[model samples]
Target: MPTITTTDGTEIFYKDWGTGQPVVFSHGWPLNGDAWDNQLKLVADNGLRGIAHDRRGHGRSTQTYVGNHMDTYADDLAALIEKLDLRDIILVGHSTGGGEVARYLGRHGSERVAKAVLLGAVPPIMLQSDTNPEGTPLEAFDGIRNGVLADRSQFYKDLSVAFYGANREGSNISDGTREAFWLWSMQVGVAAAYDCVKQFSESDFHDDLAKIDVPVLVVHGDDDQIVPIAAAALKTAEIVKDATLKVYEGAPHGIVGSSYEQRFNADLLAFAKS
Candidate 1:
């Protein structure tokens, strides 16, 4: 279990495998770097170095009662990258992890980072406000917060369906998939999970997005119900000057794990290479 202690003393467990150019993956809320398992295997076999880390309080990382915000997440990642002295890194972040990626690049990135990818990312602010009129409502995030505070287990279980778009018509509700998602969610602390709701839902990333000057790939599913493609990915492409958008029709939020795994992997590799 390889780990790097952040400035805040949190030990972030990470996996650095393979060789050649490194592709670092940051996972979504509540889940660990294991969420990028599909990506790691594919990238590693294709002659690229693949790395993924368990965010503090998620997976193998130490669970702390404090410091579970986007800035902290970015800072911790920056520390890891600096400690390892990684270069030509391709930063890939999904869901809340995308916020961390944007903030990391905004605050610390330079010529070292080759490019970035935001897949079903939570960014440019998720909660609706006067300025972010197209974002999700604060009440919606509050509902999630209340549910997690009430019963984290059940809340995560139910959210699994929404996150994978299992509720849609003709959607095959896989018990195994749902169970895996629930287990992943349960791996994190209730407090960390709850705090991350605000980290992903309320924290603004518009300024961070504007600061990126590298080629960015935005991969999103049109049928994604957890984080709508319109409000999240599409808006992100609009904000990032050098971003390219790839919209998958009828695909859910977990595009990499869902039925579109082959297509997703191929497209992602293509984007990374190009």
Candidate 2:
């Protein structure tokens, strides 16, 4: 149980494996560092260091009653990186983690980061605004918050189906994978998970995306239902200069550790080596 104590006294559990050029992974909402297991192993096998932390209030991390927003999330990551004295890092984030990485570079700058990758990420903003009319509606997130408050366990179990595209036609997600997602979601604190619904859906990343100067790879599943490509990855790639876009045909949102793990890992390793 390796961990780091944040400035606010929250203990963040993390996994660090192998050694070489470093790759730091930030996972999606309601998931712990375990979500990056496949990616971490792949990078480690390729002679690169892979590190991932359970965000505060999730998994083995402290279940604090406050400070669950994006800013605090980024700060906590910064503390982890600084405490470990890591350099020349490639920051890879998935779903909500993508927003965390964007906000991290926006606030902390890219001095230590060499590259960034966002997979099925929520960025540039996920909520509909005057300028961004194609974004997901607030009602959707509100429904999620309500679902968590009403029956968190059942809510997560149900979400796992869509998260891994288990319900999609031609989908072949294993029962074990779906169960793993549910178990991970259930590990998160209800309060933190509820607050994060707003954090990921409402928090605007326009400025954050603009601040990213390093090489960025934005990967999204064209069939993603959680964060639609029109509002998320598509818009994100446009906002981040020199960002490369990779659209996974027929892939679902949970691509990294699920059925697309091999392809995802290969792409990630190639990017890390480039």
Best by lDDT: 2
Colliding residue pairs in candidate 1: none
Q: Give candidate 1's root-mean-square deviation (CA, Å).
A: 1.3
lDDT of 1: 0.87
lDDT of every model, 2 decimals: 0.87, 0.91
Misplaced by over 4 Å in model 1 are 256-259
What residue pairs are clashing in model 2?
A: none
The lDDT of model 2 is 0.91
| Candidate 2 TM-score, true structure as reference | 0.98
By TM-score, the best candidate is 2
